[model samples]
Target: MSNKYEEIAQAAIKLFEQKGYHATSVQDIADEVGLQKGSLYHYISSKEELLMKITQQSISGFNRRLEKIIETQVSAKDRLILAIQNHVVSVAANLEMTTVLLREALSLEPEHHTVIKNETDRYLSLWAQIIDEGVKAGEFKPGNSRLIALAILGSCNWVYRWYQEGGKLTPEEIGSYFAHIFIDGIKK
Candidate 1:
C-alpha cells in the first residue's frame, strides 16, 4: 500500500544507494518505477529535491522515534539501551533508505547539508544526554559525553554498509552488543 510519491521516493532511494546520488538520473529512477521520464517530474521537482526529501525523511524519522524513547521516565541506562535498540532496529528495517541517507547526505547542497547536519546533531545529542544523565547519577563514568555519543552513533551507522536483510544477527542482537560495549565500558 503506497502512494505515487512514496513509490517514487523508495525507488529513488534504491537508485541512490546502488548508483549513488550524483550518478543517479531522474531517468534512471523513472525507469525503475516504470514511469515515463517526464512523468517523474510531476511527482518530484528535481533530483536534488529528491535527495533532500530522502535525507530529511530518514533523519526526521530517526529523530522522532529516538526522541520518544529518550523521553521515557526510565533510568538513563535503560533509556540508553532502548535508544540503541531502537536505532539499530530502524536502520536494519529500512536498509536502502538508511543507506541512501547516510551515503548521499554529504553530496547535498550546502544549505541542505546544513539542515541535515543540524538534524544529525540533534539526534546524536539524545545519546549524549543519556550518557550525561547516567554520569550525574554516578551510574556511569563521566568524560566527554558528546564524544561518547558520536562513537556510539558512528558504530551504529556502520550497519548501513554491511547489514544484510537476512543476516545471522538480528537488529536486537546487534543493538544489544553495541549497548553492552558502550554501557559496560562506561559504567562506574
Candidate 2:
C-alpha cells in the first residue's frame, strides 16, 4: 500500500474507533486525514471500502504474527501463553484497528462481513489447536477445547474495553495474569 493510502486508512480507523462506523461520515475521515472530501476518492472507492481495507490489513497482520507463533518450537502450554501475549500486545499497539474490528466489522457489507468473520474464526482456530494439544498431552484437563478456546479468546479479546497503554498493568503483565488463571484455576 502507498504511504498516502495507509495514512488515510489509518485516519479512517481512528475515526471509526472513536465515533463508530455508522456515526462516521466520509467527510469525517477526509478531515481526519487532512484531505479534501473529493480527494479521498483518489485513494478509496467509498467509506465502507476504507473500513474493509483497515479490517483486512489489521486481520492479515495479526494472522501473520500468530502464524509465526504456531511455527515456533514452544510447548502447547507456552504457545497458549504466547498467543495471549501476542493478542494483548497487538491490541495495545493497534488499539484503534482492534477496536474497529471488535466494534465495526460486523456492520460492514455482507461480503466483507463474511471475509472478516472467517479470518477471525481462523485466528481462533489456531488457539483451539493449541488447547487441544495441551489436553491431549495431559497438560490440561480433559474437556471441551472449543469452549476453553472461546473462554480464553473472550478474556484476551475484550482487553480493548479497559486496556490503557500507560495503565498499571502492561500488556505482558496482563497476558501473564490471564495465562496463570487459564492454565491453572483457583482451586487447590
lDDT of candidate model 1 versus the reference: 0.90
RMSD of each: 1.5, 1.8
| Local distance difference test, each candidate | 0.90, 0.86
Clashing pairs in 1: none
Tell me the tens digit of each residue's lDDT in model 2 across 1-188: 78989899888888899899999999998888898989989989998898888898888887888889888897778888898898888888889999998889988899999999999889888878888887777777777777888998899889988898799989989988998888885111
List candidate 1 segments past 4 Å from native: none
**TM-scores, each model vs. reference:** 0.96, 0.95
For each candidate, how many residue pairs have backbone atoms clashing (under 3 Å)? Answer: 0, 0
lDDT of 2 at 134: 79
Residue 28 Cα positional deviation in candidate 2, in Å, after optimal superposition: 1.2
TM-score of 2: 0.95
Distance from true location, Cα of 153 in model 2, Å: 0.7
